[model samples]
Target: MEMRKEKAALSSQQGLNHSPFHTQEHMRRVPPKEPQVTCRSNTYPKGFYCSWHLQHPTYIPTDFEVYVQHNQRPLEVTRDEVHKNRCHVKFPELFSSFPYRVNVTAVNSLGRASIVFLLVVHYHLHRGLFGPTVKPDPPEKVVAKPVANNARRLEVTWNSPSTWPDVETFPLKYFLRYRPLIRDQWQHVELSDSISHTITDAYAGKEYIIQLAAKDMEIGTWSDWSVAVHSTPWMEEPKPITSTTESDIIPETTPGPPSAAPRVGEPTAACSTLLWSTHLLLACVLLSIM
Candidate 1:
């Protein structure tokens, strides 16, 4: 047993001296061959289920090893084998916003290939059909009420979203939505051209929350819900004016005091002239008779 162990150790030392590390293969340096890599999509989201298909070019051996390098360091990723010209690679985390290169190498039964492939991994923003891209800006102000002549009707008035330098022409279409405050249901009213609307079927004295959204026609996107405004119709009953109590009635038929006669000496100038005229007339008559 001792001789057998000694013989095995001697053979191992001889093989080690003839190996590539001890010969010119160790001293000689060769540039790592750049493998041929291709990408399917230019942009991809992080943490989602996505695959990157990669394969080396035509070579002696079709086997290859895959690796992901972040900042020039090998990432902790398990490479999957492929039967065809494709291999699926998954990313656990998104490192940067820009593109990151993926390195792929080929290996065969003889030995691992020195060739490597570099692929760009593009990162995309996390977004859905209706994601959180909606801006949190407040909504415009709106006022609504019933007309005087109509009892079961309402008229709504609105002003554009208050902004500095005053928006000359509002480019967005307004969406007016309202429903009973107490109920869970709602009603939507879409105004294509007009900002104000006249709605008649609303309940009397009921409060409602009117919502508004500004549609960006340029980008064809709708902004988030603006700040909500509350509205309630007037409920006070109309009262008529009437004099029902005695205190409210006006007084009539008041009595007047008696008046005294004029003084006897006040008219003497006019009365004496009239008496002298009458005496002259009587003397003329007596003379005529004599």
Candidate 2:
């Protein structure tokens, strides 16, 4: 089992190498978009972090930089453990202030596009232009499954993002969106401080795509939507029909009446009439003999 898992991982990693970025068609282009830096504190008063990403693969050795800006001192960025395009910066300071400037740029072999977010920023004004809180990371480990025996119900569940250190102290609310593959519109709902929800009105037997976003309860903007999870509502299985042979059949029978016996469920008068007819027949026989 472990060997099979290793082989599967290896196959996926190798597939990454087969991308067009690895080919020699074109290389070394200027960064397409400016970096839009988002720095926020999921755990307030303790510290805050900033993270940004390269829009697309560069095909060459690439690195990211996040600066303190005011002091021109470069803030060290650590690459995320899972996502290579993104990097992280941890700062002991905090903020909520007048909008600060952010510059984002992307250059790479996969150069389709890039963009910069020129919105609010700063280290220590005690509140963003919008509010005191900031958008938390999106929900994690999202799962969507069909409810058993319910063709129109879908159950979904997820966990708080790991970036939020104190879930018990500072709760998070969620927004869920889902749509079936056949439709373009999405159905959305707000789940207050809950990690699970049931979509009771899902189309029966239809496959659905679901995603979730999170924010600090009562404050802050919503995070980006989480990765999508797909599911299908339940459908009952058809029952098999069994065949019966002659041996399994019992033919119905009717016995001949003895002396005109009354049928079952008949009135008691039927039995009396049968007896009177017998007596009249006997009398007629005696007269003939005389």
Candidate 3:
């Protein structure tokens, strides 16, 4: 029995010396250092995620394992495909007073290291845990101008906030508020998914104060109001013209003379008188001649 024990111990030592993983150089390799882990609830009550990175490299390929516990019960963890160092877990119960404990372990052929984190879930404190908390900044460079030919309409335009990195992934909606300077009440309009809007009910020729605010369509809080701008509805003032030259004023014309009238009466009487005067003159001539 003693010989058999000694032979077994000798065989184990020989195997360790000859093993590829137990080589002198490989045994000298450093073990993976403890990872730095951070956990946050992205969309409160919906889910939470954790990310970890090694404090120091172990000079060998390493793999990560994430484990979550709630009230001492193990919860399932899902790895994020896009982020190799990150993993996500769903909330079993929202607003639970019990804390969640997470442990992340980094393993290599040489050795393994681990880190642990404790998180408390609160609904109100987590502003945008249902989605990303990255809210767009207030719309910048906002301008309000009256339409050129519209007396009661104003056109407003603005550019998207610069802080919003991805517009395609997270579309935004807008709210426009305006009121005449003399009135205390304000009129507001919500735009579905546009950066420009036309105010069709503005008081004609009145000066108005206009402002804009924006928010993500799926998540996040609305941004603060943009800078206020003052503008008035378009109006055309009447212009008078003064005539300084005589050519500009037309001259009045005088009436023409009356036309002569044609002979209408005493035509028969004048013919008879002419015939009797001829007969008398003929008789006197005959007497003189005789």
Cα lDDT of all candidates, in order? 0.52, 0.70, 0.80
User: What's the true lDDT of residue 175 in model 3?
Assistant: 88
Q: Which candidate tops lDDT?
A: 3
- Per TM-score, what order, best first? 2, 3, 1
Model 2: lDDT to the true structure: 0.70
Better of 1 and 2 by TM-score: 2
For residues 46-143, write the lDDT of model 2, one tens digit per residue: 44455665554454554554334323334455666886555554442344443433334454544434344333443433332234436787899999
Candidate 3 C-alpha lDDT tens digits along 42-141: 3334567788998787767899988999999999999989999998788787556677899989999888888888875433444323333334568989
| Per-prediction TM-score | 0.35, 0.53, 0.42
Model 1, range 95-212, lDDT digits (tens) per residue? 4533334556655444444434444443334321111221212345666665665544567776654431113332446677777688778778766646688767667777777677
Candidate 3 whole-model C-alpha lDDT, 0 to 1? 0.80
Query: What is the Cα-based lDDT of residue 286 in candidate 1?
Result: 100
Q: Ten residues in a row with the worst lDDT in model 2? A: 124-133
Question: Which 10 residues in a row give candidate 1 its minimum summed lDDT?
Answer: 41-50
